[model samples]
Target: MITDTHTHLYSAEFDEDRAAMIQRAKDAGVSRFFIPAIDSTYTNRMLTLEKENPNDVFLMMGLHPTSVKENYLEELAHVKEWIDKKSFCAIGEIGIDLYWDSTFIKQQQEAFRTQIKWAKEKKIPIVIHCRDAFNEVFEVLESEKENTLRGIFHCFTGTLAQAKQAISYNMKLGIGGVATFKNGKIDKFLNEIDLTHIVLETDAPYLAPKPFRGKRNESAYITNVIDKLVDIYQVSYQEIAAITTQNSKDVFGI
Candidate 1:
């Protein structure tokens, strides 16, 4: 079975056919779905999705970097409240995202560091959402470096050097639909990285693989990603699925 280590299944984009979408994923052998929080606004919906899917959906609680705005402290407080209330598989979709807006870069850094510390304290992994801020994200990670700090670098689209650096910080590279894109450079050197340090994700409702590129993504589409990885790693389909699924379990402890 394949595990989508990072996917926003709770997003409103799936409202019309959420159940059908999930069933399709299961049918495609993508059985595990790791849902990351964007902010407190979607907390109830995310929990509701997990409640409905129970065995299929797992939740991670954190304020997304792109959501770090004027009242980010309040958002972080909400994240802490949820963590204190119950269990979470990870502490992310948190990191730096300077691609969309740089106005809150400082706030994003603070939120990222704070969440990373919280993850370490809770002994749970983190799922980072980095976009055009590799140096910035690496800076915070370097400062907070420790044996306990660990997680996945979601939607990894960096060079080999950055991939190694992220792995050095105890993170697995979250390979997604981008790997199937002709311009997505990660595919060029993915073979150099071990499958042990890679995990599959779709980042659903976004970053669909080739042929489905620019279209709204769903969990079932992860097959396209798997196909791409099979070519990149020169491995059998079952081997890729088994190894990457184990990698996901390694990071999330689930």
Candidate 2:
């Protein structure tokens, strides 16, 4: 079975046929779905998804970097409340994202660090959402480095050096549909990185693989990504699926 370590399956984009979309993924052998948090706004929807698909959907709670605003502390407080109230698979989809707005970079950093502390305290892994702020994310991770800090770098599109650095900080590289893109450079050197340090994700309803590129993505499309990995790693499809699934379990402790 394949585990989609990161997928916003709760996204409204799939509202038209959410159940059917998820069924397609399961039909394609993509069974496990780890859902990331955007903020308090989507918590109820996330909870409902998990409730409906108790065995298939796992949840993570945190305020996403892009959601960091002047009142970020209040959002963080809500995250803390959720952590205390229920169980979750991880503590994230949280990190730095300067790609959109640099105005709240400082708040993002603070929120990231604060949430990292919560994860460490709760002894749960974190799933990071980094975009155009690798250095900033790395700096915070470096300062908070310890045995307690463990998670996946969601939608990893970084240099070899950055990949190694993230791994050094107890993170697994989350390879997604981007790897199947012709211009996605990670595929060029993915073989150099051990599959053990990697996990598969779709970031679905977002970065769909080639042929489906620029279109709305769904978990069912992860097969395209698996196909690309087969070529990149020169391995059997079953082997790629098994190894990445195991890698996902390793990171999420599932």
Candidate 3:
């Protein structure tokens, strides 16, 4: 079974066809969908998604770095409150994001560290969303390193050295549509990294794969990712699916 280790299934983009979209993923052999949080605004939508797909969906609670702003503390409180009150698979999609604005870099760093501490305390994993801030993200992970500080580096598109560094910190490389891009350098050396350290994701409604690239993404297109991995690792599609799904379970614990 394919496990989309990271997917924003509740994004407004799926509002009109969420159920059908999920069905398509199942039809495509995707059995698990791990949902990440953007901020408190999307919390209810996320829970509603889980309610509708209880057997196949898992939830994560955290304040997204991009969502870090003037009232970031309040947002972080929302994340911590939900985390304390319910069972979540992980504490993410959290981490440094300098891709857009760096005005709140300090706040982003604080939020990343705080959430990492919470995830460590709960013994659950973290799903990072590092964007143009690998060094900053790595700095936090490095300082917060511990036996329980483990997770998936969501949407990983880093150098081989960065990939190995993330693995050293107990993170699985979350491979997605980027791997299918014509210039997605990761695919060139992905075979060098063992499949055991890879996990598949679509980041749906965002980074769709080739043939469907530049279009709206969905879990149904996860097979495109699997197909890419099959070529990258020179393994069968079934082998790539099983191995990456297993890698996801290793991080999410479900």
Better of 1 and 3 by lDDT: 1
Q: Per-prediction TM-score, please?
A: 0.99, 0.99, 0.99
Of candidate 2, the 10-residue stretch with the lowest lDDT total is: 244-253
lDDT of 3 by residue, 1-254 (tens): 99998899999898899899999999999999999999999999999999988899999999999999999999999998898999999999999999899999999999999999999889999999999999999999889998777899999999999999999999999999999999999998899999999999999989999989999999999999988888888889999988888888888889
Clash count for each candidate, listed in order shown: 0, 0, 0
Candidate 3 collision pairs: none
Q: Model 2, residue 129: what's the lDDT?
A: 90
Off by over 4 Å in 3: none
**Each model's RMSD to truth, in Å?**
0.7, 0.7, 0.6
Candidate 1, residues 74-149: lDDT per residue as tens digits? 9999999999899999998899998999999989999999999899989999999999999999999999989887
Candidate 3 has what TM-score?
0.99
| Model 1 regions lying over 4 Å from their true place | none
Lowest summed lDDT across 10 adjacent residues in model 3 is found at: 244-253
Q: What TM-score, to 2 decimals, does candidate 2 have?
A: 0.99
